[model samples]
Target: MKILIVGTGGVGGYFGGRLAQAGHEVTFIARGKHREAIEKHGLDVKSINGNFSVTNISVTDKISDVPRPDLIIVSVKAWQVKDIAQQLKPVIGKETMVLPLQNGVLASDELKEFLPQQNVLSGLCRIISKIDGPGKINHLAVDPTIVFGECDNSKTDRVYALEKVFNDSGFKGRVAKDIQSDIWKKFISICVSAWLAVTRSTYGEVREQPETRKVMRDLFEEVTELAYKKGVNIEPDFVDKTMAFIDTFPPESTSSLTRDVWEGKPSELEYQNGSVVKLADEIGLDVPINRFIYYSLILMEEKAKKK
Candidate 1:
């Protein structure tokens, strides 16, 4: 299969490298120093699963040079999805399947704005990965799971085939019965953690303060309720289930947003908490907690950009 992986960050780089290791034809889209490093030295993945390198890679920043891919896996930050999707219009073929592995729930809808809905899959990845250096991906934690399915929750052959592709690459990939809800399940946790972590700079403080933990759990409840209101078939126990999951985050762990903020980088603040607040406003639902976090982070991000 000819696969195109956009934004060779932790999720894309690690998974794309695994696919290349499985002997599949993969093209990577990256820019700047990262692209230069890969062009010269190949992509390196340091995984707790196992470390490996893929050299002689097909990588370029130009979309015009890319072949019409059988699959396009988008791993950019949630905020970059729209522009990337528009840029992908040239390479998207009638048979191409686009999988969005970013955090937050807006990715598929954002892709749908530029590509056919049939071509977009509702997906999210479970992994802790990041660029340790130029052309280098570090998988710090998680078993590297990818849960995806058709946008309408159909059991299509394409989903099964993609699941096979993921499994063949030695990652835990599966089709979700309800992909939107699965996405919301991921959203509930990531939204809470990203906001609290971004605001407080560490989970250690929140983990210590009973009141902060309460606020954190409330944020999860807001998103879960919002998902239910939006007609996603989330589990009834989503809040409790998600809160338990949050307890397991490693002591030093922070959301990707927090990491990006610390590095003075642009983040998905708009797509994560910001999206939740925007949606709630449209539906006449109140999301004060999400609203507060979203606006607060926007200020922080602006300050970071000026530095």
Candidate 2:
């Protein structure tokens, strides 16, 4: 399959490398030092599963340089979806499938606003990875899974074909029964952990401390309420389930948001907690926990944007 990876950071680099390893034609869109490193030394992936490099593959800073792909995996930060969608217009063919593996639930919707609805897929990825260096990707944790489906959860040939592509590429890919619910399941865990982790606590510290744990539950409940209000089918015991999932994380684990904030880089704060607060407010629901998290860190977020 011909694939275009919109961002060659952790998620994009790891998965795109795997695809290229499987002999698929994969092009990566990267910038600055990362793009330079890939063009010179190839894209290197150091994974717990295995380490490999894909040299002589197409790497470019501009999306227009690539041909129309069969699939476009958007692995950029959730907050960048809107602008990325705009830039993708020229390369998006009628049959191109755009899969957004962003952190939050709003990415597909954001894409729909700019692109054709038929071209966007609701999706999320489960992988702990990042750019370890300019052209290097480190797969630190998780089995590297991508859960995706059509917007209405219908079974389609394209969905299954993509699943086959992932299977051949050496990763777990499942067509979700209900992609919206699956997305929320991911959102609940990531949103709760990210805000708490920003308080300079690791997963071990956040889960082990009583006061912090309570705050975690409160944050989970607020997002749950927001999910319910938004008509997403989150189960009643989802909070407990999500907490259990978090418990499975390695003790020192931190969310991407926390790491970005620590490095003084722009983050998905607006798309994560900030989106929750905004969505909840629109429906007359109070999400005090999310609101607090959003407001408290917003100043820092603003400062990061300036940098």
Candidate 3:
């Protein structure tokens, strides 16, 4: 299948490179040093599973230069969605399926407003990956699963084809019947962990500090309540399962927001925690913890800028 990865950052770089290595026609849209590196030395994937280099990949800075693809993985940061979506118009065929692996919910709806012709699939990528340097992608662990489905859960041929491609490439990819609930489950768990981990020090810090761990659990519950109020049928033990999943995080493990803060890069706060709080307020629900973290991250971002 002809595929184009709109942003060659963490999620896009790792998954797109994997698909390319598996012999699919993949082109990476990047800019500046990252784009130059991929053009000159191919894409480097660094992971615990294994490491390999692919030099046969295609690279482009302009979307018009690429052909219309069968699938487009819109993996840019939340803040860059509008600009990137505009650029992606040239590469999106009528039947193209856009799977955005953003951190929080609302990506599909947000993109649909701009590109209404293409099919938008709600997706969640469970992994910690980042562009370590110009040419290398740092894939942190083995749980790099990609879950997605149509908004209405319709069994279309495109869904099955994409699933087959993902499964054939030796990655954990599944189509959820209830993608909305799956997105909420991930959002509730991740927002809490991202806030607590970045606020305290590290995942290790939260794991060791009983108080922080308890607070994290509380934040998860609050987020879950907000989700329920928003009309998602989350599992009763969803928060517990979320806490258990977070317990496996590596000691030094951190969120993309935390890393962005430390490295003076932009963070996706408005979508992750801030969006939850915003939605909760619209529904007349209280999400103090979520609000506090959202505001705290904004302050952290400002502080990082001054450094």
Candidate 4:
């Protein structure tokens, strides 16, 4: 399949590099030294499974330069997904599919608002990797996996084709029966974890204080409640399962949002805690814990944006 990887950061670069290694025609959309480095040397991925290089990578900041692709994998920050969705219009073909792997539940909706609903697929990526250099990506922990399906949850031919694509490329690719619910599951986890990271500092620190942990649990509960209210049927005990999952994270581990806040880099707060607050309001519910996180992250995001 001809693939265009927008925002070639760690997650994009790692998976894109693997696809290229598997000998699929791949193009990368990136900027500055990253794009230059990929065009000149190659996109490099260092992984525990294997290391490979895409020296002949097709890369350009301008989408018009590349051919219309069959699949477009959007790996940009959650806040940037809408803009990227708008930019995709020119390059989208009649049968093209846009899969957004942003770490939030609203990405498909954002894409649908710009592109035709048929062009946007319900999807999310499960990968712990990031760019280490201009054209280098480091795969840190999790085995890269992509979960995607039709928005309506139908087992269509296209969804089956995508599953085969990932399977052929030798990585995890799942076609979810309830893609919306699956997306919500991922969203709730991010909401809780990002809240903890933004407020308490680290996963370990969030676990250290009983009061902070309680707030973290409450955050999960609120998000889960919001999900159910909106018709996303997550498991009844999802909150407890998520809390147990959070406890398994290494103590020193901090969420990427927390790292961004600490380093004063741009973050996805607007779609995370902020989205929770917005959704809560839309649903006519109260999510005080998420509201607090949303406001706090907004302040940090503002300073980061200014710098």
Best by TM-score: 2
Tell me the tens digit of each residue's lDDT in model 1 across 1-307.
9999998988899999999989999999999999999999999999889999999999999866775899999998887889999899988899999999988887888899989888899899999888989999999777899999999899999999999999999898999998887888888888865555455556656766788788888898898889889998887887888777666666666767888866777787777888899999989999888888887778877876677
Clash tally, candidates in order = 0, 0, 0, 1
For 1-307, candidate 3 gives per-residue lDDT tens digits of 8898988988888889889988999999999999999999999989877887889689988888776788889898777777777777666778888888887887888788778644678888888888999978998864778889988877777788899998887577899889999988888877864565356578778867888887788888888998888889898998888777877877787777777766666677778888888988888988887788887678766675577
> What TM-score would candidate 2 get against the native?
0.97
Clashing residue pairs in candidate 4 (N, C-alpha, C atoms within 3 angstroms): 10-130
Q: What digit string (tens of lDDT, one per residue) describes model 2 on residues 37-91? A: 9999999999889888899988999999876799999999988999999999888
By lDDT, who's the top model here? 2
lDDT of each: 0.86, 0.90, 0.82, 0.85
Give RMSD to native, each candidate.
1.8, 1.2, 1.8, 1.8
* Clashes, model 3: 0
Q: Over 4 Å off in model 1, which ranges?
A: 303-307
Task: Give the per-residue lDDT digits (tens) of candidate 4, residues 140-245.
Answer: 6656899999988989999998898897886889999899998999889887656655665778788778988898889999999999899888999999898887
Q: Which parts of model 3 have CA positions greater than 4 angstroms off?
A: 197-200, 302-307
Candidate 1, run of 10 with poorest lDDT:
193-202
Better of 1 and 4 by lDDT: 1
In TM-score terms, candidate 4 sits at: 0.93
Evaluate residue 128 in candidate 2 and report its C-alpha lDDT on the 0 to 100 scale.
Answer: 85
